[model samples]
Target: MLKKLCLALALLVMPLPFVATAHAQGQSLNDILEPVRKEVGLPALAAAVIKDGRIIASGAVGTRVLGRDIPVTIDDRFHIGSDTKAMTATLAGMLVDEGKLRWDSTIGEVLGADLPGIDPTFAKITLEQLLSHTSGIPTDTKAIYEQYVDGKAYEETLSQSRLRMLRAFGKNPLKVDPNPTFHYANLGYVAAGAMIEKVAGETWEELIRRRLFDPLELKTAGLGPQATRGKFDAPVGHDVDDKGKITPRPWGPGADVPAGLGPAGVAHMSILDFARWAGWNAGEGKRGPALVKPETLKRIHRQHVTMTLENPPPGTPKSGGYGLGWGIAASPWSDNRPVLGHNGSNTMNLATIMVDPQRDIGIVVTTNFPGPKADEALQSLVRTLYQRFAK
Candidate 1:
C-alpha cells in the first residue's frame, strides 16, 4: 500500500503539462496532494483543478475501498455532506429570482399550518435568513434522525412526530434573535427545503434534481439510500481503527429526508461531478441552464451574517468563518488568501471542498474514516496544494 501511494505521489509531481494537458499552466496538482493520501488513510481519492473555463488538471489515487484492488476513478461517487447546503441555497436563490419567493419572505407564510406554534419572530424570518444561517433554529438532534433514519413503516411515523416536535418547540422562540448573527443550523436548511416544497409544489428532492443536478449534468449526484443501492462506481464508507485498518460497516441514510432537511446534507456525487460545480462557482465553466444568474451566485458567496471568532463548532479550526452554507477560511500557506467551501463529517465519513477563486483552483478531499485527524489532514492538504500551484 505504501509503495503504491509513493508511486502515485511521484507521478503527481512530474511535469507533464504538454503530454498531460491536465497539468498545464504550472500546476502541480498531485505533488501537494501526497500528504493527504498519506495522512488520511483514505482508500481512494480524486480531484480536479479548473482554470479559466477549462479542466487544467485532474487525477485519482489509491483504491476505491480497503482490501479491494479496484482503483479509484474520477467518476467514483462519494457522500458530500454539508456541501449540499450550497446547492440548496442556490435553489432558494433561483426561486427568489423567479419571483416565486422573496429573500425576506416569512417562513410562517411558507409552512403555514404545518408549523403550528411558530413564534411571531419566525414570521419575520426570511428565505435569505435561512440560507445565511440567521434563522436561530436549534440544531435538533432528534429531528436529524427523524428525517433520515431509513427503513419502513415505523421510520415514517418517527419522522412526522419529530417534525411536530420541532414545531411545538418553536413557540418558545429562537435561541438567538433572528436575521443577524450567524448560527450554523442544519435544521434551518431543513426548513428551507420545506419552504421549497410548499411553494414549488414538489418535494425537495425533485426540485433539486430539476433545478440543480439535472442542469449541471451531475448524473451521479442524488439522495443517499437510492444512489447507494444503484449500480455505479461508488465508494463505500468505512471506519478506520487506530492502527489504520479499514473496517466496513452499515450506515444507511438517516431520516433527514422525510424531515425536509435533505437540503443541508445527504447529497452524494463523484469528484468529477463536484468539480463541475466548483468550476461553475469559480466562473470557469457553464453547466446546463444557469441555475441562478451570475449575480445570484455572487450573492450566495457574500458574507451575509457575521460570526464571532469564538462561534465555530467546538473543534473547528479558529481560522474559519461561517458564510451562508459554506465556510470561509484564510489560506495559511498562501499569504492568508481566502478559500471558500464547506467541510462535512459524520460518524462514517469525512469530506472537504476548498476552492480558491483567485487562482481558479479547487480541491476536494474525502475519507471514509471518521478519525480525529481526518479534518486536520484535509485542512493541511488544502494549504499545501495552494502553496504548490498558486503563484
Candidate 2:
C-alpha cells in the first residue's frame, strides 16, 4: 500500500493568484483552482461542473509543465485516462441500440472466426461481463504491459495485439469467473473493443472519434497524449519521483499509459468539453447526441456487483460495485443514493468524474501528476465541487 501524505501546506510555495477566496468566487474558475493547484503541488489542475447537458463552471490553474512559463488554460486538453472507459461503454450501448450487438453477446461468438484455437471456456465471456468488469480476464499479462508501456507496444496495432493476447489469455484459466464479483481488467475492455470492431468493421478509436467526439462537438477532444507531438499544446503529464521532485514529460510513445489501450483509456479534452460529456451521462440518454436510449443508459449505469479492494484507501469504499464503466457507491453527501463516476490514470496523469443522476449534477477534475498525491487531491477536489453544485 502506498503511504498517504498531505501536502496541502505546499500552497506556501505557490504564487498568490488571488487575494482571497472572495476573489475566486467572483472571478474566473481558474482563480478558484489556483489555490487547490498550489496546495496539491500540481503542475496543473483543471475542473468543471455540468448540469442538464451544459457546463455550469470550469477552470484551470498552474503551468502546463513544471518549471515552465506556459500557463494552463481552460481550453487546453487534459488527459482523462480510464475515464475514457465510460465513453467506450457508451459506444457499446449505441451499437446495442442499432441492433448490431447485444449486451450479452459473448466474446467467442463475436470473434470466434478470427480465433479458432482459443479456449472453449472463454467462449462464454459476454459483453455485459466485459463492460461490467465481471469477465474472467486476468488483470495482468505481457500484452497488458505492451498496452501501457510504449517501449513495449511492440509492432502490431493495438487491436491486433489484443486479439492475439486474447487467444493467449484463453489458453490460461480466467482470473475470476463471470458473475457479480467485480475485478477491474483493462484487457476486458480491449476484448470488448475487439468485439466492437468485429461488429462495426472499425477500430475502437475510430468509432469513438466518429460516433462520440464528432457528434458531441468536443472541439478539444483528441486521442493519445494530451500534449501535441513535439509541442506543449496543453499540460503534459508529470511524473513525481520518490524524492518529491516533479519532472515534466514530453509527448511520446510512452507519454501515455497505452495508446493501444484506447478502449480502456487514452482520451483527452478540455474541462468544459469533459463537463459536457459527464452531463450527457448524467442525463442518462435523455439529452441530445441521443447516442443511446435512456433504457440502455440505465443498463450501463446499473450496478452489476460489489468490488473488493485488498487494501482499500481512506475515503473509498472497501467494497464498491461497478456498472458498465462507472463505480457505484453510496456517498453520505449524495443523500443516500448511489453516485456514478470513475477515475483514470496512465501512471503520469489523473482525471476523475463523479455524477449524480438523481441530482442531475456531474463533476470532473484533472491533474498533470499521477500517484497517491494526485488521487488524494482530486478526491477532495471532486467532493468539494459536488457539494457546492449538487442540489
Candidate 3:
C-alpha cells in the first residue's frame, strides 16, 4: 500500500488551472486519460476541468466493467463516495441562509426532544462542529455496528433510522473535546442531516434533491450506486482483492455504504455535472440560481479544523485544514494558495475534486476501480491537467 499522503495531490506534488501545450490543445480528454487508465489497471477513468463555471474539457474512457467490452461514455455516472460530504455541507448552508438553521445550531436545539436521554455533552455539539468533523462523535466502532450496521433498519425511514442512531450514540461520553479535536466521523454528518430533516420536515435525500440538485440543475445527480439497477448504463465500481483481482459491483444495496449514511457521502453524477458543481463552488456564488450567499458559500469552503493525521484512511485527507465539507490546503505545486478539494471512495471506486478559487479553475477525476493505483492515477492526471491548463 502507498504511504498515506496529505491530500489527493499530496500523494502524487502534495497536490489545479489552465494553458495546454501546443500539442495538448489537439488532444482529446480520452487521448490524455487512456494511457494512465491502462497503466493503473482501472476499469474506467473520467475527468473534467472547469474555468469560470463551465467545463472547458472533459472525457471518459475504458470499459464499464473489467472483463467486458461495454465502453463508458463521457455521460456515465461514477459514485462520488465521501465527496458527497461537501454537497451535504452546502445543503446545510442553504438552510442556514434561509434562517432554518445556523452554523452554531446545537444538537440539543435540533434533536434533543427526539433524543430525550441524550448526553448533555453530546447535545452541545453544533451544526458547524458536526460538518467539520469536530463533534467528537467516535468514528466507526462496535457500538456503531450493533446500533446501525447489523440492524440495517430496513423497516425504518432514512430519517427515522438516523434518529435511532442519534438516540443510541448521543448517550455516550464524547471521544474528544468537541471544540478543537478533529476526528473525521461520518456519524456527525448523519446527525447534521437528521437535524436538517427535523427542521425541514423532509428526508435529507428529498431536501437535497429539491433544494440543491434541482436548483443547481444537476440532473444526473442521485443517491446510492451510480449505475442504474440491473444495467451497466454507467461505470460500475470494482472491488480489488488482496491478490489483485477486480470484481464488478454494478448495482445493489451491497454496492454502497448504508442509506442512513448518505448524508456523510454517497452521491454520483456524470463528470460534466460533477464539474458543474465544482465550478459553481469555484465561482463562489458569482453566478447561480443563487442557492446561498457568496459569503455563506465562502464559510463552507473555509477550513474549520486542522487535520493532523499522519496516515489517514485511503481517499481522505492526511494533512490539511478541513472546512465544513471541503479540504483546504496549499499543494506543493500551488505556490501556497490554499485550494479546496476532497476525495471519495467506497473501496470500489474513487472520485476527486480540486478547486482553485483564486484561479477560477477546478479539476475532477474519477475511476471505477479503487485503491492505491487509482489514487496514483488521479494524482498524475491532476498534475498533468494543471500543467496543461493553469498557465
State the C-alpha lDDT per candidate: 0.61, 0.76, 0.80
Worst 10 residues of 2 by lDDT: 3-12
Better of 2 and 3 by lDDT: 3
Query: What are the runs in model 2 whose C-alpha is more than 4 Å off?
Result: 1-27, 141-143, 146-154, 175-179, 242-245, 313-316
- Residue-wise lDDT of candidate 2 within 1-391, one digit each (tens)? 1111111100011222323223212224676677777877788898887877666677788888888899987788998887888889989999999999999899888999877777777877899989887886755556555434544347777777767767766666554543466667787888898898889988888899999999988889998888878799899988777797766776776577555678888899988888888888888767787888888989899888787777654334666678898888776666667788787877678888888888788888888888776777787777766766676
TM-score of 1: 0.80
Q: Write the per-residue lDDT of candidate 3 for residues 249-359, one digit (tens) a residue.
A: 988766777778889888899988888898888888788889888889889988889987866765455677989888887766677778888888877888888888888
- Deviation of model 2 at 146, angstroms: 5.2
Cα lDDT of model 1 by residue, 1-391, tens digit: 1000000000012223322433332233454444467666666565565555456566556665667776766667776667788888888888888988888778778776788767887655778888877787645456444434434435454335435544755566655552477666666776777777777877777888987888888888877532344432566666555596666543343311332346777677876677677767766234436778677777787667655545444235454455567666664464675567787654455567766667777666665545556666655655544555555
TM-score of each: 0.80, 0.89, 0.92
Candidate 3 residue-pair clash tally: 9
* Runs of candidate 1 exceeding 4 Å displacement: 1-35, 140-168, 176-179, 225-227, 230-232, 240-247, 250-260, 284-288, 309-315
Instruction: Say which candidate scores most in lDDT.
Output: 3
Candidate 1 at residue 340, lDDT?
Answer: 73
